[model samples]
Target chain A: MQAFDIEVTLGRTRVLHGVDFTAKPGQVTAIVGPNGSGKTTLLRATTGEIPFTGRVLLNGEDVARQKPWQLAAIRGVQPQSTTIAFPFTVVEIVRLGLTAGLSAANTDLPVRALEKVDLTGFENRMYQDLSGGEQQRVQLARVLTQIWQPMVDGTPRWLILDEPVASLDIGHQFTVMDLTRDFATRGGGVVAVMHDLNLTAMFADRVVLMQDGRIAAQGTPSEVLTDATLTQTYGCPIPVNTTPPVGMPFLLPQARMTREPC
Target chain B: MSLAVDAPSVHAPPMDRRVQARRLTVALSLLLAVTSVFSLAWGASGTSLWAAMADLAAGRELSRLDRIVLFDIRLPRLCLGILVGASLAASGAVMQGLFRNPLADPGLIGVSAGAGLAAITAIVLGAMLPPAIRELTGNYLVPISAFFGGWGSTLVLYRVATRHGQTSVATMLLAGIALGALAGALSGILVYMADDSQLRDLTFWGMGSLAGATWAKVMAATPIILAALAVTPFLARGLNGLALGEAAAGHIGISVQLIKNTSILAVAAATGAAVAVSGGIGFIGIVVPHLLRLATGPDHHSLLPNAALLGATLLLAADMIARVIIAPAELPIGIVTAVLGAPVFLWILLKRRGALGL
Candidate 1:
């Protein structure tokens, strides 16, 4: 999947500059940036949730020309938050994926997706009664149910998530990241906007760093997660360090007052 | 994170939802049947239900009085009650799903008030028209104008609520109230100009009754109401998708705009036709859907059909109470519905007070 020269203006404010992005099959691409840096806007445009000036191509077909049901067959999206006014049970919420527009034959996918999210017994519980973390996982289960198989007809399906792990506990964070990793390993493309730099470092094969509605850097973690780039883009001092076993780069913030004179 | 070793199996899958919906439909149908019989048997005309049934079974001819009272008077009233009731309830459920709020009712959104204003104008001022015009419309003028009035107000409210590509629920709610109040003020002015006889008609009509039911009125409204109800099942899947919110629903292949437009039009058509036939009947629209929502989860596939059935049954039951509560003199059907429905509405509010954000 690819986006070329995307530009968006919401009312009077130009929210996205001309931005280009790409997500390859069999890889997890992480988009990390500060708040209001156009990360979610970019994802929204690419997924056809919002209109933009540039072109988004999915499997060599222009998304703008495609019908919604046609798009539903190959991609699933998890928005930042879903506000459900009526009382819906967990399983009922998940079941919407099957009836939404996809003609997938898997009727039991909702339960299986719940089990994958460690929410097997929560099927009958009221969604409103669950905690923030549980609700986020339930949403993940919903999207997973939409695109149950990683690939169909030798073309990889895509999962576009916006802050997928923001409300999750540390354990569930790893659980969700592992699920994305597994999907990528099984030949699906996963593009996600992430707030946790460490998690992005651990799971992302490619990282795109954004600042002020523009991509400031894009590369492997070692190339994008450099000390100068982090400090410049975040407007704070962040030192980059490497883990022992995997040699993945992680950011460690240093207090300004404790730093020695350079 | 390491996965758990053992997970307890939740209880066996609950009753099949399809089976439950079918059972609900069957139960409501039986309830409606019983109420219709009661309505026919007992009326101010004092018909004996046992004798009527026995005579019919024996292939005996009914007396002229029985034929006039039963076939002409009671049957049409019963049919109108069912049609009006089902339309109101089904419209309520669709509106709630469209707005994603349980508090949304056709009355609250100004459709009833707008239709009421049009009907009142026709009642008080319609006599002043030339003979030819009056002769052209005859019995159908009030309903036709009422339908247009309801549709007009809804179109304006929708325009106010939606800007660019999005609809704001808060704006829609507040705008509906404003529009309703405006329509009411205009209706009051029309009432002031009415003479004594017109004033009496307006008062009785405002309170609502099935006493004026006629075969012509029923025939006029059946087409509109049935058309609206027939289109609801097709809207159910789109409404279910809408429960996920607009953007997510769009991602799932629903044309969000199409769903919103179709739902608004259907609700307007149903609510308009119902209000035109029976003036300002409240409670069924708001109360029936809430009761059904409590019984069944928010799946529109079942909720829409069940709402239509239960709405019809409850209205018929209420109409029956209106008939016998005063025996020889009939009470207004609207009063009985309010007396029964207001308490249920309050109970729901109290139970969900924390969630209501009131």
Candidate 2:
């Protein structure tokens, strides 16, 4: 998946400004930024969920020229949150994914997806009755059902998720991240807007860090997650540390008063 | 890795009501068949369906009275009942799906009132049209006018209630009340301008009945109603996707714009034709779909077809009660449906008060 010179304007405010993005198959790409830094906007524009000025190419086909069904066959999107209008069972919600895309012939995908999201026994339960984290996982299961096969016809499919783990508990968060990693390992492209930098460092093959609607940095976790870059982009004094064995980068922000005693 | 290793057993079948819903479809079809027989058999006329069948069994020709009553009077009424009933209920389900609110109905939201107003205008002022146009429209003038009216009102209501792809249920209901009252006031003026003969026509029409059912009315409504219902099965998948809201629906490969436009047109066509033929019937639209949702799930694939059957059966049963409750004089069918359906609607409202955020 690739986007070139993408720009998005919401009302009078320009949220994204001439941003270029790309994600290769067999990789997990995470876009991480502070609130209002346009990570979600860039993702939405790439998915064609909102109008934007640019070109988005998915699997070498211009997304603007492709029909929605054609696009759906190549990619599945999971929104930040979903509000269902009627009472639907968990299985029914997951099964809705089966009507679209290349996965339509895969009748077993919904059950398999539920198991992946750790909601295997929730098929009979009402979606409205689920907890916030549970609902988020159910939505992931549905999206997973849509793109059950990571690659179709030797072409890589994509999972474009907006904050897929924002509402999840720690354990379920790892569960979802692992699923995305598995898809990437199986030759599908995974692009996600992430909030937790630690999780991004752990799971993302590449990280694009943004500030003020522009890509401040883009590289592997170690190259882009230094203390100076983190402090400059987030406007806080964030101290970066590396695990001794693997040299994996992590950060913990300390309170100003605690660092300098009154 | 450990969590993945200890995953839940994958042998359990995924739970769904497809089998039960299919079975319910068959059950509802049988119910509609029985209701149609009873509706044809029991009426103010003395001719009996059993006697006619018995005569046929004995190889004797039926009398003129039986033939006229059964074939002429009762058959047309039954056909109109089925067409109008199915139209109203299916329209209701589609509208609710489009608006993402179960409370959205043609009758409740002024689409029916708008159609009724246009129909009254046609009845009162149709003679004033130029000779060329009058001859051109003939029997179709009222229904066509009603269709445009219904289409216009639904479009305007949709615009008012939805903003930025979100529909406000409160705004929709309030706007519906305002639109209904506006149509009602205009209809009252048209009613006042009608002549003595036209006034009698208007009164009974406003109350709503199958008494005016004729082969002409049935033929006129059949094509439009059937055409509208035909568009619904195509709409079922789109409507199901829309339950997750417009943006999410679009993400799932549904052409959301096409679905919304088609749903509006179908609702207008069905509601307009039904209202044109039968005047203003209340509650059937809202009541039938809501009841069906409770019995089965809200999956439109089953909900819409079952709604049509249940709507037809319920309307016929209500018409039967209207025929016998007052006996010979006959009350209006609308009154019977409203009386039977209003309490159930209220009960639903009470049950889902929290969900509705009322």
DockQ (CA atoms), all models: 0.58, 0.49
List residue ranges in candidate 1 displaced over 4 A.
Answer: A101-104, A242-262, B1-9, B14-16, B122-140, B159-172, B194-201
**What TM-score goes with each of the models?**
0.91, 0.93
Best candidate, DockQ-wise?
1
Model 2 pairs in collision: none
For B155-213, candidate 1 gives per-residue lDDT tens digits of 88878876644456678779989998998999999999999998877886677888888
TM-score of 2: 0.93
Q: Is the docking of candidate 1 incorrect, acceptable, medium or high quality?
A: medium
Q: Which candidate tops TM-score?
A: 2
Name the 10 consecutive residues with the lowest summed lDDT in model 1 chain B.
B1-10
Candidate 2 positional error at B18, Å: 0.7
Residue B348 alpha-carbon offset, candidate 2, angstroms: 1.8
lDDT by residue for model 2 (B1-358), tens: 8866656544456545887889999999999999999999999988989999999999999999999899889999999999999999999999999999888999989999999998899999988989899899888888888998899999999999998788998999999999999999999999989999989778866778888899999988998999999999999999999998888888789999999999999999999999999988888988988887777789999999988888899989999999999998999999998888789878978887877776
Lowest summed lDDT across 10 adjacent residues in model 2 chain B is found at B6-15
lDDT of each: 0.85, 0.89
